[model samples]
Each structure stands twice: as C-alpha cells, then as structure tokens.
Target: MTTKTIREIALAWKSDKQRYVKQSTYAAYVLILENHLLPSFGDYDSLSEKLVQEFVLQKLENGLSVKTVKDILIVLKMVMKFGVKNEWMNYCEWDIKYPTSETNKDLEVLTIAHHKKILDFIKENFTFRNLGIYISLTTGLRIGEICGLKWSDIDVCNETITVRRTIERIYMVEGDCKHTELVINTPKTKNSCREIPMNKELLAMVKPLKKVVNNEFYVLTNEEKPTEPRTYRNYYHRLMKRLEIPRLKYHGLRHSFATRCIESNCDYKTVSVLLGHANITTTLNLYVHPNMEQKKRCITKMLKSLRK
Candidate 1:
C-alpha cells in the first residue's frame, strides 16, 4: 500500500466512518481535523507523543483557550489512532490530556425568577413558542431533541416521548436540509435516544400544538414540516430582545432546566437520565451539583437530626 499524508489518512477515516455516525458529529470531526489538526501536523506521517504535547503548548501560547485546544488535541489523537490502524504509522502514546478547567465548576444557570420572566415574555409575545420552550425548560431536552421531535415520538396516552433523532445546525456546503438549511442529524449517542415522561402542562401545551399540526410532528414548519433550529434561534433571540431580558444563548434554557431540577431537590441520577446524559458524572460536571446554599441546607438538616 502506498503511504499517505496525514491529511489523506484523516480524510479517508472520515469518509469510511461517515455512514456509521450522525452527520452533525461527522461535521464536527471534519472541522476539528481540517481546521486544527492537519494544519499543524500535516507534514508528518506520524507524530511523537512529545511532539504532540509541544504542539498543544504552542496552541495554548498562541492564545487558544485551553478548552478549544483540548478539543483540537482530541481530534488529533483520533486521527493518529486512525493512521495507526491503517498501518500508515506505528503505535504512538496518546499523551494529550484535557486540561481541567475551573470554569466547569458550576454552570451559570437561569434563576427561577428569570425562568418565570422568560416564560411570561414568551406567553405574552409568542404563544406558539411556548410549547417548545416549556418542554425544554421542564424536561431538560436538548434543543436538537426538541426540534427533531415528531408526533409519533410523543405518547400522550402513555405520557412519554421517545427521543430518537436530533435536529442540529451543520454547515453543509450545499443546501439539503430545507427546514433549516443546516444539516439535521440523529442524536449524538445511544443514551441520548431516551424516553422522557411528559408533564401535565407540557402535555396540555403539546395537545393544542398537535391539533394545529393535524397529527404531524409536534413541532413543524408552516406546511407541517419539521421546524429548523435556525428559525427557532431567530425567534428565541427576537423574543429575548423584545422582553429586555438578559441575552443568553438558547442553550441556556437547558441549563436553566437542570438548575431548576437540582433546586427542586431532584437527584443527579434522575436529572442525568432526564437530560439523556451518558452518565451521572456528566450531569454533575456540566450542571451545578450542589451549590453553597444547598450544601448549607444539607448541613443544617444534618445538625437538626443530630440534635434530635
């Protein structure tokens, strides 16, 4: 077999694995490889562990945040493994480890008051937007999961919704996804494909929304097609601006839901399952686990028990 360049090997791996993964994930892997990995180590057929570490340090020096550089390094490691499997390069130690960032200590989640304000604003200004936001805020569903939702996925009779697909905004060179113009893809992982119970309020909201759809997707386009993430983002942004509320990314809604769940004394494992997180550790790491207030309350309750 003829030896191939790092770029060629990376592209081959991507092409071979494209069918096995969701388009959104493939796009992310392609982006990291194209923009970060190949540019730095394209000349080398195989990289040394020490060399890879040095490259990571240089990226950090070049003003790349540790988080971004960490993601880039992960992509490099994947490509290197691909090269090794293809016999383009010998086995090399995977040395680059993601740096621990303190920023992940606690998520900046929306407060209950803020949640109420946002909900009120949506109800007053855009009643149609209410169902989607309500479901996300209540169930902690990812934006893509909510957007990819179909009527068939929702079981009003059972009060559960099956999360099978996810609608994400992927940058495709050509326009294929008509609803969003961004590539819509499946859920990222098997765990992401979960079944969550529907709250009574969410059920009520969806019932009317489904009536409008005439038994199509719970969320759809004007002609009853699936609603796109881009359109929802635009509407969400407009709603935020009009309401004069703090402009947080639409993703903040999911964070808000997680925060509210924790505050309501919901356990981490349950929240993790609700969020479709791969594990409880991910839920604890990404969402606020136990804030100072919660800690104090726990201590106080324990002391009361001791006194008793």
Candidate 2:
C-alpha cells in the first residue's frame, strides 16, 4: 500500500486524467485542485467528513455560490477515488449538503419592452458585434459558441446557423493545456454541436452578406481572428449602458430566448434541443415556472376534457 499524501496522489491523478478528458475540462480540474482542494486538504493523509464539511462552510461563507462549491467537491471526490484505487489514500462516501434557505437566485431577464428596444436598435444601427446579441436572443446561443462562430457555419440557402465550436479563456497551470489561455474547441457536448434555424428577421439580416463576407471569418469580428468572451462581454455591457436598459449578464440573452419559447407554449423538448441542453429537465427547471394564469389555464383545460 502507498502512503503518499492527498497532494501527491492529486498530482499523479491530474496527469493521468489529462489523457482522458478534453483540454478545457482537464484545465478546470487542475484549477479546482490547486486553488481549493490542495490548499485545504492536500497535506492530509486521509480526508474526513467533518473537515470536508468545515471546508464547505468556509467556502459558502467566503461567497462562493452553492453550485461552485458543489463542483469543487466533485473534483475533490474524484481525486480521492483515484487515490483509493491506487492504494494511496482511504475512501469515504461523503454526503455533502448545502443550506437550502440561503436565498432565491432569480435569473436575470430582459423585460419585453427592453428586449424589443434592443432588437430594434440592432436592426437600425447594424454592427457585427450587435448581431451576436440578436442571435443569442433569437437562437439561445451561449456566449462562447457565438464568439466562436464562423461565416461558413451560417447557411443562407438552408436558413440555419450550425453551432460548431466555442471559445473561452481557459485557466491553465503546468503540465497540461499550455498552448494559449484563449481556446477555440468543440461545443460543450455532443448535444451542443447543433443546428438552429434562423427566424425570418435574422435570415433577412444575414442573407445579404453571405456572398460578400469571407467564409472563414468569424461572424462576430468579420475577421480571421475571433474576439474572446471577456472582450465581447464588455462590449455588450457598453451597449446596455448606451441604451439605458438594465444590465444583465450576457447569458441572460439565452435565458430570455428560452423563456420566450416557454411563454409561446412551444414544446419543452423542442426548446431543449434548440438550446443545446444535454437534457430536457434542465430546460424545464430553468424555464418552466408557471404563474397563476398558466396554472388556471391548465386546470380549465383538464376539467373541460374530463367533462367531454
């Protein structure tokens, strides 16, 4: 049996893991291990429920979101399991819990008025960057996916935009994914590699440029090199300020799109597919909050059918 500390096993585990996962995923794991797990538990010979619980509470107190803390715990458990298999550390099935009564995390969304105003502005004063925001609202594209889009991915003849790649600035450390911080890679999952149809307005806006723009150029920049997410986010924030609309995170555009789909009574499965969600349940939980009117309508429909 080996007696290496958690830190030792983690180092070996990371190197081994790099071979199996995407560079972006591997980079994320490394960041978690180094920044959170290593500083807290690396020197320990064995991890315990109490100490891990304390770590969780500390992270929560330090303002990390419950989701972020849970993700960190997931990486911690992965390393522990890897160590157990190698006989470098002991194992425990830790049932970590988070306080449920913390706060209601409401999603940021554009009011219908603000949404229409932004779209109208983009149409009147056209820019490539502004087009990205319009696409997200209409198509539910994640920021990175839109940033990575190329002219060739948009098909004027077919009237579709194919999500092929996503661009992000990945956190990196020694031993892996060291080429560049800014990366362009395949979409988040197999489901993310999807094709979404453009609505008439979006199609009309882009069809004219199809022949004139270089096919290899990124849609956002209309240039060979693409703008990264951080830069794009700044641009979006400036536009929001100019228009005097309440500022929302860039992802709120996708959220707004899905919300509109749900409001239109579009099928959940169709909305999920269009959003490139790996599962339909994700689409439901995020977008399917029924109000009193919707609930009333549902009851009325059910009772009417029963009477018939």
Candidate 3:
C-alpha cells in the first residue's frame, strides 16, 4: 500500500477538478488549498476527524468567520474524497461543532433616509460611474454583476435589464509568484440570469445614454474596457464620504434593495428571485427580520383574529 501526503493528493485533485469547474470556481479552490489547507495539513500522511475539528477551532479562534472556516473544510473534504476514491487515503465522517452560544451579527442595511439621499444625489449629479450605484439600489444587482453590465443588456422598448454576466478579479499563484487577473463569466447562479423590469424612472435615466453608447461598452465606464469591482468599490467609498453617509459594504446596496422590497410588502419568493438567491429560505433568513412596529402589528392582528 502506498501512502500519499495530503499535498500530493490535493495537487492531483486540483488537476482533475480544474477541468470541471468555472475559472472563478477553480481559482477559489486553488486559493483555499494554497492559503488555508496546504499550509496546515500538507505533509500529513493521514487525516482524521479530530485533526480537522481542531483546525476548525483554531481558524475560529484566529478570527476567521464560521462561513469561511466551513468553506475551507468543504475544500478539505473534497480533496479527502478524491484521495479515498483513488485508494490514496481512508475516509472518515466529520461531525464538527462550534460554541453553542455563537451568534451571527445582523446584516447591515441603509436606512430609508440614507437610501433616498444617495439616490437623489446620484440622480442630481449623474455620471456613468454614478449610474451603477443607482442601478444597484433600484435593482438588486451585486457589485460584480453591475460592473459587468453592458449597454446592450438594457432594453428601452421593453423597459428591462437582462442580467447575463458578472466580472471579478481572481488571484493566481505560480511558482514563487502571485498575480491577479480580471475575469468575466456567467452570473453566479442560473437564477441570476433572469430579466428585471425597469421602473419608469430607471428607464428614463438610462434610455438616452443607451442610444449614444456602443452596445458592447460597459455601463459603468461607457467604454469597451470595463471597470473592475475594486475600482468601483473605491469610487463608492469616495461617494459615501462626499455625501456624509456612513460607510457600508458594496453588498449592502443589494441588501438595502431587498430590505426595501420586503418593506413594500413584496412577496418573499419574488424578492428571492430578484436577488437571484438559490432558495426562498435564504431571502427570508437575511431580510425578514421584523421590526418592533411590525411585531406589534402582528400581535394586534392575531388578537383581532382571535376575537372574531
């Protein structure tokens, strides 16, 4: 029986997996293997549940979030599974546990006033870059999706915007060298490939610009060369500073949009589809936190129903 080190198995697994996944997905797997998994377990000739659980605890103690740790574990498991299939390692099920008192922080979202303030300011001082901010607030496009958007995706006749692709920067590590490159790919999920109807205001704002821009030009830059998300995020940071608004993550725009939809009594499923969530439960868990006023109304309605 030949024993293989974790690093050997992982390298073999990556070679096999790369052909089956998207470039972005492959990049992420490589990053996790290099940065997290390989450094910790590369030379180990055998893997055990206890070792993996300790790794989980150590990652959490070092300030990595639960989600990130779990993602690492998932990659580890994939490599382990690949090893088992090739008779290079044994298989063992893991039942990892975290502190029972663990709590997730509330998601950040903009208040209605701040949300409106940003929108009004953007409309008043509109530029091609500023328009991306507006589109994110009105439609629930992620920053990557917004950056990848082209003028051709907008339809003036139908008053809709089609979400087809997304752009992201991925890091690559070669022999003693690390570099990064921008990639444009299909949306994160199949559901993200749908069309969103533009309200009259959004249509009116973008219609004239669409006529003058080349179809293949990106919306944010109005040029053939697209602006990447990092640059756009920096622009957002500066915009917030100028507006005297508190700093929120670029993703908060999507959250703010979903929150506004829920506040407006939009159906949960509709909101899920708009945000391109894979499941309705995800939408509910993230954006369905009822405020005190809503709770009070719910109680009152329950009492009223009982009395009737």
Candidate 4:
C-alpha cells in the first residue's frame, strides 16, 4: 500500500490551518505534531488503528499520566480528522481509550488562614512579586495571562483588566541546538480574550505598580521582557519556603482563586469569564468543587424547598 509520511501530511495539515486559524494555534499544532506526534507515528501507516491503540496502551503502561496521554490523543485525533476532511486519507473506527486518573484526595486548596498567611508574608516581604501574587489571588488570571499583562491593558479608573495576551515559552529549533525563549502572544481562545473587573484592594495595588513599571513591557517581568513561566514557579517556591507554607503548584493560585470565588457566592459565569475559560461548563467542572460549607448550603436550600 502506498502511504505518505506522517510528517509530510502533518505539515500539510498545519499549513492548511494557518490559512484560516489563529497564528498561535497553528504554531501550537505544528509544534505538537513535530515534537510529539511525528516522532511516534511518522513511520507507521496513517490508516492503522492497531498502531494507534498500541501506542495509547503503551503510554499507559509506561506510566504516562492520563492527562498527558489524553492531550496527545487529542492532537492525533485532530490530524486524523483533518486528513479525512481533505481526502488525504480515510480511516474511521479508530478509538483511543485513556485510562482514568487516580483520585488525588490530597489536592491542595488554600484555607482562609493559609491564604492570609501567604498574603501577609508577601506584604511584609515587599518583594517585586507581591503584586503578582495579589492580583492572581484576587482575579483568578491564568499564569500565562498574568505574565502577559501590561500597564496598557489596565484601566485604573474603570477598575478592570483586559486579558488580551499570554506569555509562553517555546523551545526554538536552531540548526544543532534547541533553546527555549519567552514569547508574548494573544490569548489561547476568543473566550480567553476578556475583561475582568477588579476589586478595590487590587485596584489600589496595581494602579501604583503600573506607574513604576515600564509602560511598554509586561507587568511581571522586571527586565521589560516576557517572564519565563519556570522562573515564576521558582519565585513562588522560594516564597513558600520563606513563609513556611506548604508547597503547591504555581497554578494552585488560579484554583485557589476560583474556589474562593465560588465559596464567596460569586456567579459561575462571572468566575468563568474571570478565569478566561472557553466555556462555563469547563469552569463548573474544574472550579465549582464543593467544600463542606458549600455542601451544607446546598442541603439547607434543598430542605427549605420541601417546606413549600
């Protein structure tokens, strides 16, 4: 059977998307195809479900996390779908069953006391990163979005922040050596490009910080360049160590903000837009997790309805 190389077809597919899709998205598709997909499937027949299933199972057996495997499958599925639509190939009936992720009961959520302690630590330390921590906790901005923020996107009088871009790091493929570089690009989706109203305290803090920061550069980067995501992670780690607080992923700030918003009785759609999620359902699934207080409130509301 005559078959085209997966690399060639994937490039063709990427080029086709570049014609109509967002540049950042098209770039992501090309990167994932080159770095992850083609490396695994380039030599195989594009129509082989057996190879795809074996690859999925092998990934699971090799202890690749379920989320990672699911993401990979998503990319592969896109390429295959594109192939079918363009008549480059036709292979229906292919399926990838990703195993369930084990429940992590100990997933960290900051209590009010813990949140206060961290905030107080930041206040007393007077570090350059204080505003970042404050804004993230108050606003639920994704790390990339926060890092991408600039003074120009902020409106002091209006008390709002416009989320128009994201800071990302990509490994640049040079002739012989690969090096990572920080880049600023538009937000990941149309839904992610949004505006969020700021609370009073955040407004007071950011207004002054904006004055001191370079007007043309990102808010978080001290050198007027895009902030490396890993550097921010390290800074958070150091902050945790100094405060004697338990370590959580830098992304935990985003989750903590969302969880706090729900507990404080903020609306789901509001929280969804604040977090720049593409859909309210995604926000509900991820951030509307019920704590004991929330569960108790639900029960009370249900029981009260019975009185009628």
Candidate 5:
C-alpha cells in the first residue's frame, strides 16, 4: 500500500467521481473542494474525526452557516471514504456537533394579501416574463425549473406541466480567475422531475400564448434561448419594487405556495409531490406550523376525549 496526502486523494477521487454526477453537481463539488477543503486539509498527512471537528468549528467561527459547513464536510467525507476504499488512508467514524443555541430560523412566506396582490396585478397586466412568476406562485416551481420551462412541457389538453429540466449559472475557477457559465440539466433528484396539474386560471393564461409560440421556445422568453435565473430574478425584484411590495427572496414564492396549500388543508404527501420534494418530511418541516386556531382545536379535542 502507498501513503498519499489528502490533496492527492481528493484529485483522484474527483477524477473518478465526475463521470457519475451531473456537470452542475461536479462543478459544485469542485468549488467546495477548492475553496474550503484544499486550503485547510490538502497537505495534512492523515485525517481524524478530531481534526474534522476542529475544521467544522473553525468554519462556523468564520461565519459560514451550519448547512454550508455541513455541505463542505460531506465533500470531505466522500474523499476520505474514497481514500480508505483504495487503501490510501485509514477510516474512522465521525459524529459532528454544532452549537445548540443556533436554531434554524422559520422560512419566510408571503401573506395572503401580498400573494393576492401580486397575482391580481399579473392578471390585470400580463406579460411573458410575468407568467413565470405566476407559475411559481401557483405551482411552487423553483427558479431554475421555471426558467427552464418550455412550451412543449405544458399539456393544455390534460392541464398539466412537466418539470423536465432546470437551468442555473455555475461558478468555475481556472487557476487565478473565476468565471460563470449557464448550464441546463436534469434536476438533481428524481422527485424534482414531476408533473403538476395546472389550475384553470393558469391554463387559460397559457392556452392562447401556446398557439403562436414555438414548441421549443422557453415559456419565460418565448424563444429558443431561455432567460437565465439571475436575469429573471432581477425582473422579479423590479416588479416587486414597482408594486410597493416588501422585498422577499425569489424562493419565497415557492414557500408562499406551500404555505397556502397547508393553509387550505392540503394533504401533506400530496403537497410534497407537488413541490417535488424528495420526501414528505421536507414539506412538513418547512410549512406545517400550527396557528392559534389549530392549537385551540387540538386542545378542545383532547378535553372532549377525556370526558369519554
């Protein structure tokens, strides 16, 4: 067996791993490795759980979010596991911990009035770009998915839309320079490739436009070349500003859709599928908080059961 440094193992692992993952995913892994792992542990002779724990703590102290740190650790573990499998290093179990005082903050969602206001304004003055926002508000499509949507993906007769692909700009580092490229690829998970039923309102808006547009054209641009997410995001921001609505991240549209579904008593599993979540727990965790009325009803039911 031959001993190798972490950097050597990482380079080998990356070369082997690239063939199995999507380009966007491979790019992300490379970015994390170059920015976080290589700088800290590349030259280290050996890896241990204690060393990894300290790395995690240092990353957190430098103002990285817990989730971001965890992502970096995941890449680290993958490379470490690769090294062990190839007999280049020893393996050890790792159980990392974080500060308990740090809690995941509640997700931000639009209020009913704000949601309706945006919808109403779009209805009154509709544009192709505005239609993307409408689709997100109604169907909970992510920015990438919506931007990637094509006219062919919509089934007017069946009133369904297929989420087949997504587009995003990925950052690439070459030596000392950094650049970005827009990539269109299949969604990261199978669950993200889903079909959502279009409401009558959405169908009506899309029907007339679909007749004249090229099937290959993107819904947001109505051309072969689709608008990138960053550009669409800027459009969304300007619309919100002009309407005097409070600024919310583009992802808030998805949260608002899920929240409205839960508010209307939509089943948890069904909402999970509609949102194209990998599992139901994601739906529950992000959107299932009970209000005062729900809590009160639960208590009342408990008291009634006691009487029995």
Candidate 6:
C-alpha cells in the first residue's frame, strides 16, 4: 500500500471531490475534516472500527448531537474509501452505535396563535425581509432557499415560486489558508430544485413586485448582491422580539408551514414534495403527530365503519 497519512489522503480527496460537488457541500466536508477528523486521526494510516467507535462516543460526550456525529462519520467513511481505493490505506468496516436518548427533542413550531399573529403582522407591514418570512410561513422554504431567491424565480404568471439555488456563508480551508465566503449554489438535492405553488396571499404580494423588480436581482435585497442566511436570521429574531412573540429559530417558520399543512390534512406525499424532502417518510416523521382529539375521532370513525 502507498504510504500516505489520513491527512494527506483527505486533502487530496476533498480537492478531487470539489469538482463534483457544490461549493457549499465541499466547504462542509472540509470544515468537518479539518475541525474534527484530521485533528483526531490525520496521522493514522489505518482506520479500525473500534477507534472510530471511541471517537463517536467522545464526540457525543463533547456535546455533538447524534445526527451531527453521524454526518461527520459519513464524511470520514467517504475519505477512507477514497484512500482505500488508491491503496493508501486499509478500511475496516464500521458498526458504530449511538446511544438512544430519552430526551429527543420534539420538533419546534410556531403555535397556531403565533402563526396567525406573524402572518397578520406581515400582511399589514411590508419589507423585503418580512416578505421572505411571509414566503416561509406560507410555503415551507428553507432559509437558504428563501435567501437565494431572485425576482426571476417568482412566477406570478403561474403563481409558483421555483427553487433553483440557495445562499450561505461557507468556511473553506485551502492549504494553510482559512477563510469564509458567501456562496450561491444550487439547492442541496435534486428534489430541492422544485416548484411550489404560491397560495393566494403570497401570489397577491408577489404579483405586483414581479412587474417592477430587476429579474436578476435577489428578492431579499432587491439588489445584485444577496443577504446571507445569518443576517436574515438575525432580522427574523428581532422581528419576533418586537412583536412580543416567543423566540423560534428561523427554521421554525418552515416547520410551522409544514405543520399547518399536515394539520389541514394535506397528503403526506404532496407535503414532502413541496418541502423538497428526499422521502415522504421524512415529512411523516417530522409532522405526522396525531393529537388526542384526532386519535379519538380516528377511533370513532374506524368503529363506525364496522358497526354491526
């Protein structure tokens, strides 16, 4: 086998991997490699399942969420495979285990009252940022996707908003240089590049603006330059505070949208597609919680159908 440390192989792997991935994705891999994997295992030439398992537990103890730890492992596995393919290292199969926590957080969403309050407030007050939040409340657009939107993507004629790209600030480590850049890249998955039909409220607001705004300019800024997610998130937080609304992460807007849809009895597959989820199961897992009232009604309906 070629004698290359994991660090060397990882550098080469990410460099080659960049051409095939979006800039944001490559940045994520690099950040995880440098911040976690390389520091821990860079000099090692071989990876054993036990060593990785230990690393997993250490990460968990250090406060990384199970999902985050799993994502890090995924990148680690890919790099190991690359090194193995090139004969630089040997791969041991991983059967890593994660501890199940009873405190798994339920999904957070705006209460129905808060949801109505924000929508009503935004309906009366108009700002580009508010418009973006309005879009999220009415349709389950992720923060990056909403920030990436341009006037051109607003199809008032068809009453749909087509998602094509997303904007974010990404950390990139090149050689010895470490820096961050604001990047605009296509949505994370093919399913994310989708068309969501605008509801009446959204259509009304967008229709007039589409006629006057520069098609190539971003919607949030109404300029060629874009507002990144962090900045927009701050704006959202301040708006929530001003309205005396309890804090919710910007992402909660998307969750609220999805929750409202499911509560309205929108089909699971349709909600999945609109949210750009890779699978309907993800949508179900996040939002298919049946309340006790619904449970009672379901039981009643089921029994009614079998009446003797």
lDDT of 2 by residue, 1-308 (tens): 87889899998998899899988999899889888999999899898898899999999999999989999998989888998999987898777778887875777899889989999999998999999999999999999999999999999999999999999999888865444499899999999999999999999999999979999999999999999999999999999999999889999999999988988999999999999999999898888999999899999999999999
lDDT of 1 by residue, 202-230 (tens): 67656665555555544544235667777
lDDT string for model 6 (1-308, tens) is 67799999998898799899888788899899988999999999889998999999999999999989999999999999999999998878989988877366888899999999999999899899899999999889999999999999999888899999998888988889999999888897999999999989888888888888999999999999999999999999999999999989999999999999999999999999999998998898889989999999999999999995
In model 5, pairs of residues that clash are: none
RMSD of 1: 3.7
Candidate 2 least-lDDT 10 residues: 171-180
lDDT of 5 at 165: 98
Total clashing pairs in model 6: 0
Model 2, CA-based lDDT: 0.93
Scored by lDDT, model 3 comes in at 0.92
TM-score, candidate 6, is 0.95
Off by over 4 Å in 1: 1-4, 97-106, 121-126, 173-181, 208-212, 218-222, 297-308
Q: Candidate 3: which stretches are off by over 4 Å?
A: 306-308
lDDT of 3 at 110: 95
Candidate 4's clash total is 0
TM-scores for the candidates: 0.84, 0.96, 0.96, 0.86, 0.96, 0.95
Better of 3 and 6 by TM-score: 3
Clashes of each: 0, 0, 0, 0, 0, 0
lDDT of each residue in 192-217, candidate 3, tens digit only: 89899898878889888877889999
Residue 303, model 5, lDDT? 100
Alpha-carbon lDDT of model 6: 0.92
What's the CA error at residue 16 for candidate 2, in Å? 0.8
lDDT of 5 by residue, 9-53 (tens): 998998999899988888899999999999999998578889989
